[model samples]
Target: MKPAVTPAPPAKDARRPPYAGYAMAAIGAALFASKGIIIKLAYAEGIDAETTLALRMILSLPFYLVIGIHALVHTRARGEALPDGRLVLRTIGVGLIGYWTSSYLDFKGLEYISAHFERLILFTYPLFVVLFGAAFFRQPVRSKALLAFAVSYAGLALLFVQNMAASGSATGTGALYVLSAAVTFALYQLLAKPLIMRIGPQLFTCVAMGAAGVAVIFHFLATHPFEAIFVSPTLWGICLALAFGATVLPSFFLSAALKQISAQANATIGMLSPVVTILLAMAVLGDTVSGSEWLGAALVILGIGWFTLSERKG
Candidate 1:
């Protein structure tokens, strides 16, 4: 009688390559960079930040609702315990800070600053992420990370100086608003990791987004007239594009990437965002780019590419 053959089990290292995480982060950052352009377009249509954000959340809510329900059902089918109330609440809180508060600040900042400058300011969130992670999470600060930051922010400083020279003190308020958004977003990235690990990225993203959507809707109703929701079809189309292209897809991509990479790495990789936003601003908005801006952008890209290669090797 022939002996029964045993099949080989999968290899321990069969998981995705680290580059896959980098790729996901890069794509997410690029997509997210489109947001500034879209918001600026909406602003040109005479849509205020409050109404724009409200419409974005309203349009995005249904997708999160459907996805959240599916994630719960899948968890049950897998015989997994559902997230406890505490976890759910914590996720929602982080979501509100990240999406609701951060987004509001960003939209308001866009009103005062150019899209390129707004993106550049917002791109500084990684510094906060690294600092907060080290302080609160006890994450080790690698020397390479500092070097990458120095290089990247050197470029950012150049752009900041040039923009300040050009725009003067008028950019101060918007800069502050975007900086606040960066801080909150940094907190979100730091806080979300453990929750994502426990509840899974798909469920966590859905819950967080759903909660933020609700919060934004409530805030809108409280501050704006009910009739403000009725906007021109062009604005609605812009909101739709913002919801799916920039918000929904990139949110999922980022959440999934977080499952694979550390928040520091993910945030650092987001340096690509400013470059994308700069190009889009020039192309779509017909904004002018200075020589210093080009040089600053080159440095940003160089630093990011260096960091990405280092991460891949690690």
Candidate 2:
């Protein structure tokens, strides 16, 4: 009997330094951070969160469609075997809930919450990623990983400490929503990560984004309608920026980065996003963080850095 062939290892050493991957992850986080500030600015101009998200998705539609069409043409010309139809369906399903619905919830939350506050909650993604990874994939939980997780949560507590004190009561409604968003966002990263590994970043993102765009467009018509979207030029411009700069561009970089980094690393690196958003808010929105917020942001960045940098190949 003939022996079976085992696949060769990836060309680049698996144990090579993770710096380049971390750098790309940082860039992707920066792009994502730009979204909240821009969305807030658009809100100040009177565009509602639903309308803003819809418009952003709409503007990004053409970019994804163009890529998908191009791929279809090229594949037909090359007579390559067709991709599995079920894969497309799965991508669409995840994109609909993960990208479209989660984004809607996030923007809506931003309307009611401070940018700093929103960021603090969002950064909980690292813990969710680690948990999801362990539960689903049985990834090992190291002592350092546990410590990093603890520090990150401590940062989140510090940022929200004032809010919790001010509340003086717990209804659990608002916090529940934020927690839901965080979980969905984490699932988004985890679900897409495997697809990205399978299909490559560009194609996966294009299809997933197209799916998200379609869902959001339908949501806009059902909820906001055409008049809401066409209300003003400033609103349209903000939406355009959200599409290209916030949604489209960042997602591509993030999807690509996922190919190079673990989901846990991606979430950890995204800890920088809160810092970037806070800085942007300060510059553009005239928002200033109190000493506590500053400390919280510092802790988040430090904890994430410790986790990513300390993970040396054994």
Candidate 3:
């Protein structure tokens, strides 16, 4: 070594992080959209909703528990106070309602609907977020937001026309279940947002996911047999995919993406999710969309995209 030359400092990043952020968001959304498709596939294997959900939670539990432990160790090293009892209880409650309850309804809904329909219905959550924010958080609802809701829902209603035409399908009931899931999920976001601000999202999510995992376990014990978990190999694959690929990994990716970009941009770019779901549903599940249904999907995407970005600007 010539005169103990100091190693050159690491090069600074010149490329803005938004490129990676957008890619992560898009990939995360696609992975998330795959949840419905995977759920449908598992249903075809004749797994009940309770057992199916429990399997997913059980498989995903390790990821959350590990994160939770990491949080604890990190906090201790930093001499930070641990979350108080109130915060812990609040997180548990949010986890129950948001993940357990919402996922229960969603899986039940998937029993009766195509993945395509399920995705379209779930995409309506932004509208519920607006309403919930206005009603509970006292956030002022602007005209543009309302207009966005109207346009999106009008598109959804047009899809309902497709259901109406194809009578005898369980579309009505499925739509209700999925819509309930979206509302509860929105509520979870609203309630957890403040707590997330107080305690970091990593810690909050770890706690919340652990709570939801416990709930699913209890539900499984109450409603399913012990032997039920040792089912067909394909079902196990689906559960693993949902737990890791769709749930845990993409969740982290979405969180990391948020760190790089604003939530507005994340949501705006996430409009691609339904498109991903649509393509998967069509290709993998052989589901078809009519012209009117395609129009409805477009309207939903455009409306929510507009609403999120516009609200951010305002």
TM-score of each: 0.83, 0.79, 0.92
Expressed as tens digits, the lDDT of each residue in 275-313 for candidate 3 is 999999999988888899899899988888888788788
Model 2 bad stretches (over 4 Å): 1-29, 74-79, 164-176, 251-272, 312-314
Task: Tell me how far the alpha carbon of residue 183 in candidate 2 is from the true structure, in angstroms, after superposition.
Answer: 1.4
For 227-261, candidate 2 gives per-residue lDDT tens digits of 77676887788778888988678877887888888
Each candidate's number of clashing pairs is 0, 0, 0
Off by over 4 Å in 3: 1-17, 167-169
User: Which residue pairs in candidate 3 collide?
Assistant: none
| C-alpha lDDT values of all predictions | 0.86, 0.76, 0.87
Evaluate model 1: give its TM-score.
Answer: 0.83
Predictions ranked by lDDT, top down?
Answer: 3, 1, 2
Report how far off residue 267 is in candidate 2 (Å).
8.8
Model 3 vs. true fold: TM: 0.92
